[model samples]
Target: MGKEQEKEVILEQMEERAVEEISTHDAEKSIEEKLVAVQEEIAGYQDKMLRAAAEFDNYKKRMERDRNAAMKYAGEHILREILPVVDNLERALNQGVVSGVDAEMKLAALLEGVQLTLKSLLAVLEKFEVKAIESVGLPFDPNIQEALVMEPSDVVPASHVLGEFEKGYYYKDRLLRVAKVIVSSGKAAS
Candidate 1:
């Protein structure tokens, strides 16, 4: 081969090598750009997951707060209903003492005042859905009455309530207290 031809062959080989290197470099750059885009998409998903977790935490806290409040005020309605009865009793007692009447006169006057106060208290209790459990002369019910004692009696039937020591009350169908009562044990009158 001649010298010029050999030099021309060498130059052509160099040009081809340059073109291949350029093409490989362009492929590497495209791959790098795709990697960056995928990373950005993953970051967006991570942010969304964090936001959802925070929202769920807030909802749980709110529910807990509401539950605590409900428990704290569970008997508020019942207490509010009974306040007026206490006030009426206080007023009756104060008025009876202030009159300064004789013992017999005072006793009669106080008795009447107490009856009226009791009636007013009953009215208030009824308005708030509180009802007195009828324990006297009725069959013993464990749910509404607690038997304090059983006694031989000529009144009513055996196992029936003869008297109530303390009144039982119901608030809106829920039992507030059980009545302390005496039950009858059938025996002939002496």
Candidate 2:
């Protein structure tokens, strides 16, 4: 309507444009900052991925090593278990139990042959990494010792092994059979 009013209105419009320009510049800067943060996050994720891949490779190698070791000692347990039987047979022969005099001679010869056979068998087992589990006078371990019975004992502590009824064998660290044992029961815990 009036020239002065028009000029005032024009000045107000110019001021509004300046404010919008400032806001646009701020928005552009914010967008750039956000892009930088997103890039940083992506870089961090990539680093984590690389670490995971490295860990997986190490795990594979470790597993392979364990597998090979298990394979190497696979037969050890069975052989170890059979060792006690050989020992028992040898003991029987040493005791010299027989019937007739002629039969006794034959039996003695048979026992000697059996002893030699057992020795040979044990030697073969030894080559395969088979080992016997120690059961006598030791603690009763459920992992290696199977409790045949709990018996009262004065010499051994309760829960300890009093005697091994049958021997256990191990192939490497794996148990083939648990040793059958009698466990000692202590003085009724008073």
Candidate 3:
């Protein structure tokens, strides 16, 4: 081969190699850019997940605080209503010891005051949806009445409530206390 032709061949080969290297470099740069973009997307998703978790924790803590407050303040309204009755009883007792009144008169006055106080208390209970259970003359119910004794009676039928020892009460559709009563047995067996 001639010298000039050989040199020209070498220069062409070098130019081709340079082009391949530049193409390879561009490909590597493109891949690096895509990697950085994918990493940024992952970081953004992680930040969102962390924020959601923090929000859920805050929600749980807020609910717990509200529940505790409700528990702490429970029955406060009922006790406030009952306190006036207590005050009335105290007033009655204080005035019950007035001088110049006879013992019998004082006793009567004190009893009247107690009756009024009891009526007031009962009214408050009624306001709060408390009601007395009717057991006398009704058939004995195990759910609301407790049988104290069985007595033979001509008037009351068997398994019927004859007399109540203590009145039962219901507080807002729920039983507060069971009625204690005597059940009657049908006329004695001959």
Candidate 4:
């Protein structure tokens, strides 16, 4: 080849190489920018996830604290209801020893006060779903009645409750106390 032709060919090859290098550098820069943007996006999502998890944890703790507080004070209302009964008994005792009242009158007043207190207490218990179980004249039930004695009674049939020593009670459909009862064993032996 001639020297000038060789020079021209060499110049064309150099220009082509320069263009290819610039294109490769530009591609590398673009890829780097895309990678940085994707990393920033991922970091933002990670921050949001961390915050959400922390908030959920805080919410759970708050609920547990509330539940514990509720449990701690669960009997507060019932105790409050019973306080007045105590107060009434105190008043009755104080009145029983007054200087002007006679002994019989004082006793009557004390008994009346006690009856009223009992009625009030029973009302409170009923409000809380407690009730008395009627055992007398009803059939004896081992589930709710405990027989203390077997009596012969013409009035009450066999296997029936003749009397209750201590009355039974129910609290919200459940037997709170079993009745101590006298069960009839049928009519007296002829």
Q: How accurate locally, in lDDT, is each candidate?
A: 0.88, 0.83, 0.93, 0.95
Ranking by TM-score: 4, 3, 1, 2
Who wins the lDDT comparison? 4
Query: On a 0 to 1 TM-score scale, where does candidate 2 land against the true structure?
Result: 0.46
The per-residue C-alpha lDDT of model 4 at residue 129 equals 97
- The residue-by-residue lDDT of candidate 3 on 63-139, one tens digit each, is 99999999999889889999989988887786679999888988888888888899989999999999999998999
- Please say which candidate is ahead in lDDT: 1 or 2: 1
Summing lDDT over every window of 10 consecutive residues in candidate 4, give the lowest-scoring window. 86-95
Task: Name the regions of candidate 4 deviating beyond 4 angstroms.
Answer: 1-27
What are the models' TM-scores? 0.67, 0.46, 0.77, 0.81
Q: Per-residue CA lDDT of candidate 2, range 72-120, in tens?
A: 9986887677776677666666556555457667677767767776776
Tens-place lDDT digits, model 1, residues 86-164: 8877876776676557778767777777898899879878888889998899999998899999998876689999999
Q: Give the higher-TM-score candidate: 2 or 3.
A: 3
After superposition, candidate 2 runs with Cα above 4 Å error: 1-3, 84-106, 112-190
Which residue pairs collide, candidate 4?
none
